[model samples]
Target: MDVIKDFPIYVAKKIKHETVDDLIRQFKGLQANCYDLMINRVVIPRDKKLKEIEKDGNADWRFHEREVKFIVRTENGSSISVEFGLCKTIKSLKDYLYDVKKVSIDQRQMTFNGQELNDEMILNDCEIINDSVVCMNKKNGMSIDIDINNVIEKFDENTIVSDVIKFRKPSNAENYDLVIDGKIVPRNMTLQEANISQQSKLKFQERNITFRVRLCNGSRIRVDMPPSKSILNLKEHLNTVEKFPVCQQRISFNGKDLTDDLTLHDCGIKDDSDVYLLGRLYGG
Candidate 1:
């Protein structure tokens, strides 16, 4: 009787252990299956969207290094189009387009918002983004103002300027190779005489580099940026630079929150490109 009782206890323990092992195995299988399903679902759609956004001349999806195809409406009402790596600089774009259309580049001035276009501006890689940065339908008048106050405003106090100067093209204004105006200033000029302060949104210089920043509407402030800096860091720097109140405002790239510390390699920012930073969209 004692042996039989002990035998029953032993068998019960073994069965219990086997049951626990089976549960663990089932859990692992479920995790693996879930992982596989998620990857399948995400990767397929992502791949398709990427393909749709990508453009090529022959439906081949061959993206250019820095080329953008422009839908230019000629003066004759005919919309002519062409593609080239626009990043070769403003000068390069004018020269090449002149060559293609056989018009003296001198006759065709690049004026973004009326100010002659500068070669330092890099054309964004995406066709849609590049399409938006407009050029001259008219020559924007250029002038210099003398303000002893040494402060200017692109708009309201939400964005103030340290005697803010405007960005201009290479030939439009330069202190020589010394100051590009919006670019590297003569490493030697003190802020007082030049009065060129950090609060300025746009400035030009005759320098080499393909970076530009554009603010949307008038956000009580404007921030300057270097070309190579990532949009992620750029946004943080903008917040700090502009003194944005914590949680009062949110920032977005194109139309999305800057999720990661994404490099320009991932951010897709270009000169004068529209970066919509507004009150975050309201939704459930």
Candidate 2:
């Protein structure tokens, strides 16, 4: 009987221990449910909202990022990638090159598809796209030194002969021939085309010839002009120097009317040749 009574006490202790264990497990499960509720109610929504914000921010960035990235290939076969806004000018690109490549702005010449790029041209206006390859050449690379009227000037080999002449003497470029090594280079050809190199010495040979112009009053005036000049140029010169109105002037050579577009050479005018100038009569 005593053993039976002790067995009941032992059973009560075991039952109490089992109740505590069940309560502990129930409390842990309640904690987990609360954690899930917190996450679903607040944390998950916040994370989704943050992701949406990040997505929108990226879209906005992409929308405003209007930049063009291109590659510049130098004469030495090296290349570099550059990026700029579409509105940026070519001058800005040159400035960047000067800073990075240590090249002066005047010496750096950029070209796209064989067309020389102007400094004032905008990047977008040049039709440059992303990943386009631009060519960068040093202007001094093929330049030749030229002496004009005792003043030495450097010009590129690709420079047109007429352009060099015009730079030296605007009013008389067409009348001058570029002489190198005792030979006359054609004015219509570039320095490179004329076989002129960096070591070449250039001189200007004036081809001016004196001619007589008979005015409407039958008075003769002596003029020195180049045969390459158009009659329009002559009329303009007369307008400036003699105060003759170009619009009212009419010229005839060899009894035939000379058009303004005809060059003196086209009319076969030579030294001491005489031409008649008459005033245009306008009727109301």
TM-score of each: 0.25, 0.32
- Note the Cα lDDT for every prediction shown: 0.38, 0.66
Model 1 bad stretches (over 4 Å): 1-64, 72-79, 113-115, 125-130, 137-284
RMSD each, Å: 23.1, 28.6
Candidate 2 local distance difference test against the native: 0.66
Task: Summarize candidate 1's per-residue lDDT along 133-186 as a digit string, tens digits.
Answer: 334222222233322224342322111121122222222222223232445433
Candidate 2's error at 180, in angstroms?
6.2
Q: What is the TM-score (0 to 1) of candidate 1?
A: 0.25
